[model samples]
Every structure is written in structure tokens, then in C-alpha cells.
Target chain A: MSVTAPKGFKASGVAAGLKTSGNLDVALLLNDGPDATAAGVFTANRVKAAPVLWSQQVLKGRAVRAVVLNAGGANACTGPAGFQDTHRTAEHVAAKLGGMGPGQVAVCSTGLIGERLPMANLLSGVDSAVRKLERTGGDDAALAIMTTDTRPKTTVVEGDGWTVGGMAKGAGMLAPAMATMLCVITTDASAGGDALHEALTQACRVTFDRLDSDGCMSTNDTVLLLASGASGVEPTQEELTEAVTKACHDLAQQLLDDAEGHTKKITIEVVGAADEQDAVEVARSIARNNLVKCALFGNDPNWGRILAAVGTTSAQFESDELNVAINGVWVCRGGAAAEDRSKVDLSGENISIVVDLNAGKQTATVWTNDLSHAYVHENSAYSS
Target chain B: MSVTAPKGFKASGVAAGLKTSGNLDVALLLNDGPDATAAGVFTANRVKAAPVLWSQQVLKGRAVRAVVLNAGGANACTGPAGFQDTHRTAEHVAAKLGGMGPGQVAVCSTGLIGERLPMANLLSGVDSAVRKLERTGGDDAALAIMTTDTRPKTTVVEGDGWTVGGMAKGAGMLAPAMATMLCVITTDASAGGDALHEALTQACRVTFDRLDSDGCMSTNDTVLLLASGASGVEPTQEELTEAVTKACHDLAQQLLDDAEGHTKKITIEVVGAADEQDAVEVARSIARNNLVKCALFGNDPNWGRILAAVGTTSAQFESDELNVAINGVWVCRGGAAAEDRSKVDLSGENISIVVDLNAGKQTATVWTNDLSHAYVHENSAYSS
Candidate 1:
């Protein structure tokens, strides 16, 4: 019960001919509410997909009755024809849902980019999904959005008398400013569009925006939050933001766990920074260092590579005043070898690397995965 | 003949016990000149090695008579003891050269970081190298400076009565602002320190500075140019710069050919940019993109990945007006699929990707390599 955990929401998933595997490739989420308030965030990549451009326009109207998402082809780089395909998809969804205006429906697509979607099959899938929409169809909707993901990611957070539910799908191309992923959230609390956008912006800033899987941004990243004020529970703005943050954090962790071809889930925690930005910059530099990632995969506590990565950042830290600890072992102190490297055990899936810049007191954490042979194989063997 | 191809230079290579394999790990290059004029460039990495710091100080003295390079250990992240080891090595080289000042001797070290050098073996090897130095020892000196490089990189360019010759060694951790490699160039032209410095700077700005293999900057990258003034020919600054640039370009190409685990040497050329910096920024963004590299390794002309990389830069270009070609096949035109991707051939070892911004008249190019399974294997299986 991801999106359906909230009140006055229905969802369904159905198979379309868009994916050659004949798997469920289309999903629809409907908001049957007295209040239809929504907010969204999109990829920062300048070359965005047609669906992303369409969804941005829909959200600007400050009302969204439903969402239509597919996992077969990313309608990107197909020129104006691609934008027309997205418009037609939204219109088809609106017609199937009792002939509502196309502006009330948002669309999203994820798969191989620079390809057009099969309109006839997608329209038929949307018709079937509208007919099958039910309160308990959220699980099927979660499964329909998966491309390379091995499992579905969903979470629910309970408030005093309301609930927030969300689902996300991503496997690779995961980096800051949003990964190559799609997400949808539903809340049954009495909040306006401003409150929902504020909560989502704040939550994603700390969660999805800190995940740097490969340091490659995507062109079709999207996250949507729909509030259907059917629970009659008017929670405070702070309360709503807190619950949304928790839900986003849970979903982000799930994405990290299922990252493609990853054996080790690494967490780089930077402390004693001059400011939060400095901490983030330093952490990101370490997260994106392929040499450091390879060393972690080999279970070698090579603090020298980590220090070299730190040096690439313009963060405030003296080279001779820095220290690093891996899995509770201080392998390096004051920018040089201190404790024996053999004391650090990296034979686990969860590895923690802590960097202490003996500067002011500011901290940040970034999540990433170790680079491995499987990562190269998965990325090279397949086009996606 | 590489460094010793000039008129007044003698060099030798000797095995040092610092390397467990007992390979030729120590090299000495002496400028037996009536006038010694030199210039040097080091790594841009803020966390520099002990040898780099020592060499930077020595270059400021406006006279460098000799250079001692070792390939067994980097002598980096080893704290004050590492600096002392470098100082001691320089002093020993000076003493072996008949009591010359230690400040006139420069040092370079490459290999695994965070390890102390075996001073006794290194000094003994230095003594042997000084005694064995000859005008025909350039090939041995080139061999001594190699860590994982399979072949020696050397080139010669003739300029009227003067000549410029150079040698380089590097296999990985190659990026802009200097690769992890070390290079030494010798010139037999009559020039002062200022002219040599200006020519050397201009030569490197367009050659070594454009080769980015793995995007990992090393803490120990050094390139030195020494003029012996033995040719007795005063060439114009343009002539000197032209000759030095040719030698550097040849050596840079050699480094690219020998990049570790690379199946394809890629050249990303950006044209029609608003300025040179924009072209370089766009080219580097595509060069450093792992997705693009992986796609190339798989022999797939995935132009969407290339377009996405181009979008990541803040270069001057309209999304709809941008174009890209893979090996002369216009795979993407006007930001959409154009020529059949099947027409593009990627079976060769050399690949060229051109991105046209259609925004201006400036252009630039960056060199990189495809990511392969061997890359992951080499980086993971070895400590370096």
C-alpha cells in the first residue's frame, strides 16, 4: 500500500506492447478528492524529456487529478514529434478518465532515450489501467515503473490521523540533482500546494540529492507529490514536512540498496567543515573517485586515494590537519598514516568512511556504491 | 635518443632495491652545459608529494643541473619523514656529482602513494647512475621512469640548428592539469630561463593538459624542460615554442596509446562554441562521462549519451540546434536521431566524436579512453 495507503486515491498497472519483454509497462494514479493539490521537481539537466516538460506545465496549473507513467521508452531527443507524443499520452489518459481536461493529467516515461513511444498500445494500456484502478493497486503500479530494478521500492509514514505514501524506481545513473529515476507520493492531509512543494523541496535536498552513484545526471528524472485532502486532518506545516521527509529518506535508502551491480553500499560522512556546502563538496568528490571506489571493492583501506580526492575539492581544510576513519578504525591521522590499515575491516556490504577536517563544526553525508566489474558489465552489455 | 638527444646531456638508469622486482627504478639526467636554463610544471592537486614540493623550490633557484627520478614509491602522504627522504636523496646526488649544491638537484617519484622510500638503496642506486651516465643512455632513463607503462615514450623535433627531445612515462590516473606521468624535455637551443619558461608553458597548455584518461589527478605529476645552450643557435621564441610543442604532442599521443585497460583512444572535438573555454568545458564533460566511455567500449554508437553529456555543461548552445557525429557519421542531428546509428563503425581502436554547438566559431578538443572490463580489473587487482 504505497500510494493507496493514503485516503481517496486509486491506482492500477497494466502491460503494454512498449516493452518487448511483455511486462507491465504502464501505470495510472487517480486522485478522487475534494481538494486536488500537487507539487513536483524535475531533472536539472538542460536536455529534458518531453514528459518532463509536459509535467512541469501541468504542475504550474496548481491542480493534478491523475498521473500516467510508463517504463518502455523515454520520449527524449525525438524532436517536436516527441513532445507531441507526450501531449497525446496525457490527452488519452484524460479521455479514459471521464473526459477530463488534458491539463489535469501529468505524464512520465523512462527507458532507452531518443526513442518514441507506441501510441496505439500505450492508449490501450491507459484505458485498461483506468478500468482497473482500485485502492489496493499501488503495489502493481510500483512494479510497472521498474526498468532495470530487481524489486519495487515503496514506503509509508503514518501521521497522527493522516498518512504519507511514496514509491521510487531507479537502478543506475544515480547522482545528485536527482538520479535517473521516477517517483510519486500521495498524502491525505489538508495542505495546499505551497506546503506540499516546500516539504518535497526540503526533503529531496537532503535525501535523493545526496545520492551519487556514478556522478552522471539524467534527462528524465522526476518526483511528484499529490495531496488529496480527504482525511479531514489538517496537520501543521511542520508535521507534514517531517512525515514527507521520513518517507523520502526511506525510499532513497531503498534505491541505494537496489543500485545496479553494487556489492557494497558506501556512506561518506564529512565532518568539521567550514560550512555545509564545503562538507557536501568534499563528500561528493570522494564519492565520485573511481580509484577510491575500486579500492573499496577490493576491501583495501587505501586512505591515500581518499585524501587525494579530498584535495580536488576547494573545501576549507588544511592538508596536514585532516583525518580519516574507515569502519571505526583511524587509518589516517593528520593527513598521514597512523593506525595500521589492516585494522580496518571492509568485508561487509555496509561500509562507512568518515573524514574529519579539523576546521569548524559542520557536517554532511553522501551515499554511493563501490565500482565493480559487474557495474561495467551491466552498463556495457545493455544499452540502457 | 630522447632526453639525451640534445647536445649537452648525459643520463643513466640503475636498479634500486626499493622495488621488490629489482627493475630499473632509479634514473639520473645531467645537463653538462656551459649555461643551465630550466622550467618545470607540477600537479595541480593541492595535496602534493614531498618530491614535488622539493622540485618546485629548486626550480625557483633559476638553475637545475640534474634530476633524479625513481619509480618504486611516490613518497606521498608519509608526513615529514617523506620530505626528509627527498632532501637526503637530493643531497646524496649532489655529493656524488662532486659536491654541487643540493639545491641544484631536482627530484621526482612515482608509484604507490603513502609509502617511505628506501633511502639507502635509493642513494646507492644514485651513485651507480651517476657513474654510468652517458650520452647514449636516454632509452634506459625512459625505462627507469615507467611504473605500469609498457613502452617508453620519446620524441624529437628539429628546429633549424637547434633540437628538442623529450621522454614521458604514465599508464593511469591521467587527467587535465597534468597526468600522473612524469616527463623531462631537453633542448640544445640558446635561450634564457624566461624564454624557455614561456615556450614550455605554451607547449604544455595544448598537449599534456588536454589528455584526460581516467580523470583522477595524481599528487606527483612533473614535467621539466632544460636547455643546455650547446647548439649555439639563437632561434626565435616562435621557433622554439613550435619545436617544443611538436615534441610534447608526440609524447602525449604515446601516453594515450598506452593508457591502462583501454580498448579505444577517444578524441572529443567541440566546434562552433562561443569561446575556447566553452569548447573545452563541453569537450571535457563528454570526455569524463563514464556512460559515454562504456558505450564506446561496447562498440555502440549511443549518441543520446553523448548529447546528455553535452547538456551537462554550461556551454553556449541551443538544445534543438546542437548536433553530434561519431566517426564521420552524423548519428544525431538537431538534437534528434538522424543518420542510422548502424552506419557508424566503432570496431577500430581510434574513435572520434564531434559535437557542434552551432553557437559560435571557437573550437577545442580533449582526449580520453573507453572504459572496459580490463580497466576495472587493473584498478582493482593492484594496490596502485
Candidate 2:
């Protein structure tokens, strides 16, 4: 099944006994003669899934017309058998696409790790999926990527001379330093595979890797962007870059907003840092902190924990170089709170923080959320 | 005031206007005689607090008569002002102790970081505390170190020759790798300062450092053990080591059990690793994963998340060398579960996980809990 969105990419989704819920588990996206230029991003985690391995290997110097993705069993850590499952899935897709080699088709799977695929059900599912492809089946492809995601995530953005569309699935947080999330973007722009690759990589770093609500990187995370040039409009480099970045930022935000049990989104802005890297190092560390997360939940405006969290990092801005702001109000400066904390409203469900390191000009903003009881409730409940 | 406990040491607790709660915030313990045989362990985070700075410099080559502690504000990141507060706090305590000098006392402050002390109230609290010294105020002193802790944490382990007493406070996991807690231990067993220091260091490794919960190390974290020699009998080297080790282990467990929002404790046992460190590295990486934490929260038995988490570490174990078990039940081996998840339950709040490296005999156990909504609620609602 396909996890891509491209013009002429007719897709179909079906439930073939892969998931116990009997929900749509197989999705196939097919491209006819005018195949869109393909660029994909796979998980950065060193331990790759079988399908991730297959896709990464396949996308090296070739363009693909289809992608096959299944939900229920992540073909990871299953050793040789896992690799075979990916190969077979690729072969099935390529064969269905008029005898192309398995190398032309990418595959992705997400679900319980360390499990084998029941070939009987999967093969039947693939056949059924291919037979029902349609030109406007973007909605069906979205259903195929669901694991624990409560809702299907899709985004369509229209830009000058082109349109950028995408979908992502991740119920929990993906660490900004490469999180656990599977994203697929389709753009009808006239660009070569290499250009799409560069755009996709650059876009993934700023868009997908900058979000760290829970700091959990999944093994099966993949983001594939297929540029089908079906729109017949050659967009400028600057416009393509901007459009890609904007879409990625939008998708990342949507994922954070829809993160399981997320009640409030907290923005951690690190300003005047020694560099963008250090600023990010400081802000993201605070974002991933469990105590800081809890404090946000309590809306206590416990700035002390924020300082403490920053102190934990290697970036040492002199104590005096540190200035902290909550929301739009400057609460702390020159190392301590600027005003009486009793007047600050830290109890709001939505929290914003800005920390300035009076050392440099580079700044970074990180999106996170307060850790809450509902988070525990949803996570501790039985698996679907 | 004093921060000591002796067979005959007197202690007192008083309110210092630092904490808005108006609860007991200052505590002092006095040995009353020559008790220079002391040892300490401090936070390894490099970013040291004022009291930690003072104590490390003073304790470098001197002995002390009392330990003075305040619970409201941590004099950290206050630039030169923070150091001044520590000096004044020590001086005030010394003055109240009649002929004692500032050098004869030690001070500890726990609460908001980057805040200045209310000098007037702090000095007054010291004076009042000195006048009300008694031998039974150890418990109250324990309460003074609390920040968001749900209870007073104090442990007294009576051994053959002396009593090893300790008090610690960390609602959010204290920093480990250095020390993630403020533990003041008092013992009557006779031992040299160097010997005591040696014992404390050796005992802390597996006990304190191994108990990595939230993995955030505080600037003010310290473990001070004082020997008053009130027992009149010097302990053997072996006996001293055993006592300190036991005390450290017991307190570490307590900290784990009291981890914030943790309804159940999960023990990750990574066995058969190539080496002990490899086993530990793999386990620690998993322990820090929020997705695994949430998965544990859900009781989903998503061993894939566990495998994915372990694989993220720098350990040398290959997928083939890895074997994972949860709650004494082997779920994933040779990279995948047995394809029978019917008995698996990811819905329970209390869960256990064990990962086997299957390559060597060395094993490491990491204690952690699932991330919960309560954790979020408390952190987000904290003071600004």
C-alpha cells in the first residue's frame, strides 16, 4: 500500500486482517505514466525497521511510483524474517505497478515491534488494495498509517504555481532530535529527485525534528515526499523552499496539538544564545524535562526548575547572561525574577516561555506541552 | 543553626520567611563538641549552587561543628549576590552559636533557584533556631528540605556499632550521574574524614547513580555524612563500608518509589550484555524514553517500543544479541514477539520489563515509571 500523495497517485485502503481492530490496515498509492518525482525521508534512528531499510535502500538513486504501508505490526527487529517481509511487500507493490523491480517501491510499517507479518493476510490485503485504487483517495491513505493515532492527520496547502499536500501519524511525541513519526508529503512541483531529496531533508530537520513534546523517537518513523510535477508549473527555488518549510512546520504543529493527552502547548523560546545550536540545546532540554513538564501541568510558573534544567546542559551562559520571560511578560532577568511571581498567572493551560542567553544572537523556539494526568490516563489504559 | 545529627547532637527547626507557606523552613543540628570527621558527595553537574560552592571549598580541608539548612530558596545563579547570601547565612549561624565562627558551620538551601534570600528573616530564623536546639528535631529538619515532595523522607538504619541516619527530598527525580538529591546523613560510628569520604563515594555509585529516574541533576544536590564519634567505638573498615552501602541503597529505593506521578515501578533488566556497561547503557537509554514511559503507562505491552528505545543507545549489542522480557515473561527474542500477544496486558498501571542481551553474563537494572498526566498537571501549574 502507498504512503504517498502525488498527482495521478490513485490510492486505496482496506482491512485485510492485519490489525485486530479490523480497521483499514493496507493502503496503496499508484502513479500512472506521469509519475511524480519522488523524495522520501526515513527514520534517523540507527536501528531501522525492515521497511525503513528497504525504503532507504530503494530511494538511493531511483524514483518510485508507489508506496505500500501497513499498520498493526512494525516489521522491525525481526532479523532476517523482518527484512524478507519488507522485500516481499516491495515486490508485491512493484509487480502490481507493471513489473517494476522491488527497488522502485518503498514500504513502511508501524505497530508492535519485534513481530512477524502474517504473509497470508498481508498478501491478500495488498492484492485487494491495488484493485481499488482511485484518483482522489488521499483520505484512504491516511487511514492506513494509523497505529495509536486518535484521528487521521492530513494537510493540503495551495501555493503559487504548485500545491503541497501531506499526512502524518504519531499519537505520542517524537523527539525534536529525530522523533518517532511517519510523515508523507506530496507536491506537484517541477523538481528533480535530488532537489526533492534536499528539500525533504532540510524540511524534516526544521519541521519534524524540532518538535519534542515527549522526546520519544520511534524506530519506524519515516517522511516521504513525492513530487509528481503533474501540475506542470516550475516553481522558483525560494518558493519551493518556503512552501516545503511552511508545510513541515504546519504538520509538526498539528502533531503536537494532537499528541495523546496533550492539554496545553508550551512554547520555549531561547534567545540571544551563543548560537542556534546552544539555544536549541537549552530549550529542548527544558522541553523534555519531566519535572518541568509537571510544573507546566501545575501552572506553577516554577522558573527555578527552568534554570535548573538549563544548568544541566553544557552550554554555560554566565548566570548574569540568563534572562527569562513567561508569555509576553519578562518575569526573570539578570538571573532572577523581575517581578513578584505571585502576580504571574502560571496556572493557565497554555504556557509560553522565553529564555534569553545574553551571549549571542542566535535563537530557537521549541514547541512542547505540560505533562498532565490525562496523559497518564490515556497512556496507562490498555492497548487498542 | 546546625545541619548535623549525633548520638548527642541537638537540633532545631524554625520558620524563615523564605517559603510563602510559612512552614518550618530552617533547621540546624549541632554536634556540640569536636566532630571534624566529615565526608560529603556533591552534584556532578558542574553548575554548583551557592551553598554547594561554600561547602565544597570549606569542606575541602576543614572540619565543622554544625550544619545549617534552609528550605525555601536556593541561592543559585544570583551572581555574586548568591555567594554573599551563603556567607551571611553561615556567619549568622556562627554568631548565634556564641564563640563559633562562620567556618565552623555548613549551610544548605533547597527551593527556588536563582532567588535571593530574605536576609532579615533568615538571620532571625537562625538565631531562634540556635536558642531552641534539642536532640529530637531531626524529623522536622527532614521536612525543611522538601520542595514538591509529598512527604518527609528520612531513614534511620541502626547497625551493630552505630546508627546511619539520612533525609532526602526530590519529588521530581533528582539528578544522578552526579547526585540528584539532597541527602544529609549522620552517623556516630568513628571514622576518619578521608575514610568516610571514600566509603561514601564507593557506596554512592550503584546506590544513588544507578537510581536514575528523571535524570535531572540539581546544582544543590549534596550528600553529607558526619561522624560525631559519640558511639565511643570505631567501626572496622569493612563494617563502615557495609553500613554506608546499605544506607545508600535503601534511600535510593525510597527515591524511586516516591518518583512523581509514578503509580508503579518498572525494573528494566538487560541481561547477557557484552559487558556490564553495555547492559547499563542500553537500559539507561530505555529508562529515559518518554514513549516507552507512556507505553508503560498504557500497559500496552508494546515490546517494540522497548526494543526501539534500547536500540537508540550506544551499546554494542546487535539485534541478534538482544532478548527482551517483561514481568518475567519473555515477549521478544531474536527480534520479534512469538506472534501470540493474547496474554500480554498493556493496560495495567504496575508493570515490569526485563531485556536480555543474550551475549554475556553481565546485567544492569534501571528503575523508572511511566509518564502520567498528573506529572503534567503539577509541572504546568507551578509558579512562574
Report the number of the highest-DockQ candidate.
Answer: 1
Candidate 1 displacement at residue A236 in angstroms: 1.9
For candidate 2, chain B by itself scores a TM value of 0.93
Worst 10 residues of 2 chain B by lDDT: B1-10
Candidate 1 lDDT for residue B323: 91
**How well is each residue in A154-242 modelled by candidate 2, as lDDT tens digits?**
88777776788777788773673443477777777778887787777787777787788777677788888777777787777777777
Q: Which 10-residue window of candidate 2 chain A scores lowest in summed lDDT?
A: A1-10
Residue B39 accuracy (lDDT) in model 1: 88
lDDT of 1 by residue, B1-384 (tens): 999998999999999876778889999999898668898888888888899999999998767899999998998888888999999999999988964689989999998888788888999999999999999898899989988898989888888888898899988888848533799999889888888888888988888888989888888989999999999988899998899889999999999999989999999999999999999999998888887888899998988888878878898898888899999999888889999998998899999999999999999889999988888888876673
Interface RMSDs of the predictions, in order, are 1.5, 2.7
Residue-level lDDT tens digits of model 1 in A247-299: 98898899899987888999999999999999999999999888888889888
DockQ, candidate 1, comes to 0.67
